[model samples]
Target chain A: MPRSSTYEAVLDASLFTPAQLQPTAVGRLAFQAGTRWMRDHVCSHRTLVHEHRVGFVLWSWQLEYVHPLRFPDADDAVVEVTARIRGPRASQLEVEMTLEGPAGVAVRTRAASVPLRLSGDEALSGVPRPLPDALVAAFHDDEIERTAHRSQVRALRAGFERDGEQLAAAVSEFRVHRHHCEVADQWYWAETLGFAAGAREELVLKYGKAVPGLRRAQAEPIRRVDVTWLRAGQLWDLLQVRTTAHRLGEGLAFVHELGLADDEDGGPYAVVVERI
Target chain B: MIVKVRGVLLRFTDYENEIEVGGNTVRAGLAALTERYPNLGKVLLDRTGEVRPTHLIALNGERLTRSELDREATDDDRVDIVTAVSGG
Candidate 1:
C-alpha cells in the first residue's frame, strides 16, 4: 500500500564531480527525487500553505550506492527516480527512494521526516506535528525495514571508544546563521542545527577523516549516512562536532556527535553515522 | 506579565494569533499559560514537570533549563520555547 511516485530529469553538469562521478552527487540526486515525491504526494506545498503548516523536516537519511554514474560528454543522461512512502510513525514518515540511469540502478535511499506546522503570528513559529491520517493510510500497515545498520554499528560502540584515540582526529565547528534558516530549503530546525544546505558535506569530510582507509584516496565517495537530530540549536549557537571511527566488515563506520559548546547538558545536538 | 509562545507551541494555546500569559516567574508564567490550555503542558513539560530534553525555554532572551524555571519573570519579560525540528 505504499504510495509511489516517479521523477524524471536529465543529469545536469552541476550534479557531476569535477573529475569523476562521486557518490555524494548520486546521493543528492536521490534525495531530490524523494523530496519531489513528498511534495507531489504526501505534503504538497499547496496543502501546507492552505493548512498553515511549515513543511516536512528530514530527521534521518540512509543511502546506498549500487552503481557508479557518469555524465556523458556529448548528450545528457536521462535519470529516472522512484520514491515510495514506506511507513508512517507517530510524527514521522519513512520514504524509500531509488535512482536509475541508462546503465542500471544507481542509488537507493531511505529518509525519515516530520511535519512542521506553524503557530502564533510568526511565520517561523511552529512545531512538529503528528503524521496526518491520510498520509499514514497511504503506506502499508507492516513496519518498514530500517535502512541504517544501527544495531550493528551500536554493538561496536564500546570498541570504537576504546580505540578512538588511535584513529585520526575528526572535529569541526560552525556558528548557526540566518541564511541557514530559509524555509523552502532549510526548514524549521535550520534555525537551530537539524539539517540545512551543505551540512552533508561537512559531515562527509569529517567522517572521511576519521576513517582512514574508508574514503577513496583520490575521489573520497561516501557510501551511506545516518543522522539523528538530538536537540534544537538556535541562530548564533556555536557547535563543536567530533567523530570516531569503527570497522564494519569491509567498510568503515563513523560516529559523529555535535553539541553546543555553551550548553552543559553534555548531550549531543545531533548524531551522524557514516558508512563508507 | 507577557508570556510569549513561539513556534508550534502556539497550536495548543487558546489564542488565535498572539498569546500573553501572566505569572511571577518562568515556572509560574508557563503554569498559568498551561492552566488555560492544558495541552500545552503535555507538550512543553514531561511527567516530572520538567521541560522536555529536546525543548528549550528562554526568558528575556536568556536560555534556561528546568532547574531555572523558578527564575524571576516580570510583566515586560518575554519567554520563548523552541524544540528540535528536521529538514534536508
Candidate 2:
C-alpha cells in the first residue's frame, strides 16, 4: 500500500508563464530532491531561477526509490533528469517515471497524464481533479496523524530549546559510557551518556559528505569520538567526538577529541564532550 | 611515549572513557598501556588496528587536535585516553 499519495501535473513550458507558477507546498516538496541536487553545481542563485526545469517532463522521472519528500518544501529545485528527456522542450512528452525515497519499500506511487488547455491570456483551464472525499478522507486522517506527530515533535523541540539552559544544567551531571570498543579506546568517560556513531560513510549517506572527498579523495581513516548524554527521551542531546588522521611516511597517526561544556546555568555536568 | 585518547563522559549512559593509541613514534608505550588496560585498546582501535572515529585522544590534560599526529613519540611522553564525543 502507498504510505501517501502525490499528484503531479506537467504543463507545456509555454503554457504557464514564469510568474504564474508560484510553487505550492506540495509542488515544492514534490521536486525538492532534484532541485537541491542542482544547487551543488549551480554557481549563482539567479541560475536557479533561469534553470528551474525539474522533473517537469513526465517521462524522465523514472527511478525505483526516488520518492517525494516527507516534509513540505518552501521552494523548488531541479536536478539531473533522465538522459532520454534532455534538450529543449518538445511539443509533447513520451517517457515514464518512478520515485520512492522518503519512506521505505512499503509504498506505491502512480502518475497520470493531464492535457493542457491554454486560453488567450495563457491560463491553464484543465487541472487535475481532486481525489474523492472518501479517498481524501483517509489521506486527511493520515495527514492529521502525521501533523499531530510533527506538531508534538515541534512542541517538544521548542520546549527543549526553551529549557536548553536547564537541560544543559541537567545534562552536565551525566556522561555516556561507550561500551563498544569499535567506538572508543576508553572503558568509561561519563558514567552516563548517549552513544551515537559518526562515521564518514554513514554521514555521506545521510547528508552527502563534502564534495572533494566523494569525488576524488582516498578513504580517510575514521575518527575516534563519543558523546556525553545530556537529556533523556525519544530525542537525545550530546557532546561530540572527533577523530583526525595523519600520515607519516607509509604509516598513519590518529588524533581525536571529546567536546564538553563543564558548566551550564551554574550547574555541574560531566562534559559529554570536553573542549579541545 | 604512548598517547591515550578518551571517549566522552556522560551521566546516565553506560561505558567508560577511551584510551586511544597514537604516535607512530610511541607505539611501544601505547602497546604497554593497552596491555595494562586491555579494555582501552579494545575500545579505541578498529578492525584495521586504527582509532575508531567515535573516540578522542587526550595528552595529559590537553586534547589532541593535530590533523595528523606525529606518530613518533619520545620515551618520556605520557598521554591520556578519553571517550568519543557528541553534541553541537
Candidate 3:
C-alpha cells in the first residue's frame, strides 16, 4: 500500500458546512455530492462535453437515498459530499443540500465541494474554468485530465511525458511527500525547477529583466515557487507528470502530466498542471 | 498590451495586441516596438540579434508553430498568442 493515502477526506462529512445548501452553481461546483449529481445529469446532455486545461478540481459524494425522488408526498432530498482540491489553489468544502422533491418529506444530507481557485501572484485572480466531470463514475485522476490532454478539446494542452526511472522517480517523489504540500513544493522546486538562492543571477546576466525568475542558478533551474491550499482529503497528492523533449526545431519542448490525487479506492480529484 | 503567456516566465508588451509577428517580415517593427517596452530587450533579441525562448513570437493574426515566426523579422508582421511558456 502506498504510504500516503487520501482516504480520510473522501469518506467523512465532519468538516462540512451548512451554508452550501443551495442548488446553484456556487453550491454545486463547491460541493462533492452536488458535483457528482450534476455531472450525471450533464453528461447525458447530447451536446455538452466538459474540457480542462491545467486548473481543474474534483469532488467525491455519497448518495443517501431520499423518498423525495419516489413518493408523491416527499418535499426535499438530502445530499452528502466530500471534495479534494488539485493544483496550487486548493481547499475542500463539505456541505449539505436540500433538494426539493414532489413529496413533502425534506431529505437532508451532507455533501462536499472541492474548489481549485486561481490563487497565486495576487496579480492573477479569476474564477477557474470548470470542473471536467460533474458526476465522476470511474476515471483515474490522470486519465480524467488525459481525456482532455490526449485530445485537443481545449485551447491549451501541455504534454509532459516521462517513463523508465524518471516516471518511477516522480511516483516515489510523490509517495515521500504524500502527506505534506510543503515537502512536495520544496522538492518540486529543487528537482523540477531547480530553484537555488542565486539561481536568478545567471538569468539576469543573460536576459536581464527578460527572465521572470532571474536569479543565480546556484544548483537548480526552479526558483522559489510554492503551492498552497491543496486538498486531496486523505488521498496522497500523487501528481503523475510526464516529461518529454520534442524538438521545436532548434528549440525544445518539455511536457508534464500533472494528475490529481485520489483515495485508495482511486477517485481522481484534479489535474494540477499539464504545463510545457 | 501586456498579455499573459502560460508557460513563459514573463511577457513582452509592444506593437498591437492582436498579432503582428508572423508576417514573413517584422524584425524592424518588432525591434522598434521594443523601444516602448525596453524591459523586453534581453528577451526578444539576443546580442547576436535573435529571438529567444524568453518570449514566444506569433504572427498572421493567428496562433501557429514557433518556427513560422522564428524567421528574421522585417518591417511589418502578424502574430497571435494564446499563451506560450516553457516550464518544467
Candidate 4:
C-alpha cells in the first residue's frame, strides 16, 4: 500500500538565522525525512546500498517556500515533516516532502533519484537501473501521472543557455574537502545548495552597486529554487561555480553552474536556478 | 615543466603535490612524470598510453585537447592533472 512517512521534532534556535528559517537547515531536514521514510516505508538504506549494491543518486530537486516565514513564538515549538514517495518511473524514484509549522506548510521539496549499481574496482557507473520489484511495490500509481519538476527545470536551463540575456556573470572556484563528502567521498548533494548560494552572494557583492536591481535579491527571500545534477564531485576535486544574473520579467533570477575547474568544455556537475 | 598532482592523484604521486620533469611536449612531460611514478601512470593513462578520457591535462590554466597533447611546452609551463571525483 502507498503510505506517507511523518517525522516530527522540536524546533531549535540553531535551525534559524536572524531573519527566517535557514534554507540549508530545511534541506538537511528534508534529506533526513526522506531517509527515514525509506527505512520505514520502503526498505532500509543498508539493504539498498550495501546488499543491493545500489545508490540513489539525485538527478533534480525543487523547493518552494509556500508561506511567509517568521520566527516561532514559542522556544519549544515543534516541526512536522511528511515525506511521500511520489513516483517511480522506469529508472527514477521521486520523493516529495512538506514541512509544516504553526503557520502551516512552510516549505515543500521534491527530489528525483535514479538507482545506480555500485561495486567492483571499476569507477562508479553513471548508467541508471530499474528499481527492484519490491521497491516498486512500495509506491502506488496515484501520483505516477503528476508533473515532474525536472522537465521544467531542464527546459528553463535550455532556454537560458540558448537565448537568455545575461545581465552579469561571475566565476568562482573551490575544492571539495572531506567534510563536504559523504560515505563514498563524493560531495553530498546538499552542498550544491551552498555552492549556488555562495555564487549568488558573490554576484551581488560584485555587481549590486552597478545593477541596483540585483540588490533586490539581497532584500527579498528566495521564493523558488530548482536544481539538476549531472555529476558528482569527489573529495579533493577542484570545482568552479559560474553564476549568471538574469531578468525574469520584473523579478530577478540567478543561475549557478558547478563544474570541474579543469574542464572548460565539459558540462556542469549541477545547475541551480533561484528566483528572488 | 611542473606537473601538479591534485586530490586522489596525490596518492599515486607519493603525496608529492608538484613534480618537476623535463619534456618538450605536453605528452612528453606527462610521460616523464608517469615514468617517475609508475603507479601514477596506471591510474592516469589507458592501455594505449593515452591520457584517459576521465582525466584532463591542462597547460597553465587552459585545458588541452587529446590532439593537442603533442603541443610543445617549456620548463616555465605548468601542467595540472585533473579528474572529477564526485560522481552520481
DockQ, prediction 1: 0.14
Candidate 2 deviant stretches above 4 angstroms: A1-276, B1-24, B58-88
lDDT of 3 by residue, A55-174 (tens): 223232222223323322332233333222233322333334434444432334333334332322111121334344443323234322211111121222222232211111122123
Measured with C-alpha atoms, the lDDT of residue B5 in candidate 2 is 35
Off by over 4 Å in 3: A1-54, A57-79, A84-276, B1-57, B61-68, B73-76, B84-88
In angstroms, how far off is A191's CA in candidate 2?
Answer: 13
Q: Which ten residues in a row have the lowest lDDT in candidate 1 chain A?
A: A184-193
lDDT (Cα, tens digit) per residue for candidate 4, span A41-101: 6677877766665667787888888875566643433334433333434466677788776
B1-88 per-residue lDDT for model 1 (tens digits): 5666543444566533345778789899888877887787776666777766646788876889778989988888888776554222
Between candidates 1 and 4, the one scoring higher on DockQ is 4
The alpha-carbon RMSD values of the candidates against the true structure, listed in the order shown, are: 7.9, 25.3, 22.5, 5.7
Best by DockQ: 4
Model 4 DockQ, alpha carbons vs. true complex: 0.18
Candidate 4 lands at a TM-score of 0.73
lDDT of 2 by residue, B1-79 (tens): 5453333222211332233444444445556655655555555455655645544455444556534344556645666
Most TM-score-accurate candidate: 4
How far off is residue A188 in model 2, in Å? 14
**Model 3 TM-score?**
0.25
Candidate 4: regions farther than 4 A off: A72-89, A120-127, A140-149, A158-165, B1-88
Model 1 TM-score (2 dp): 0.62
Tell me how each candidate scores on DockQ against the true complex: 0.14, 0.02, 0.01, 0.18
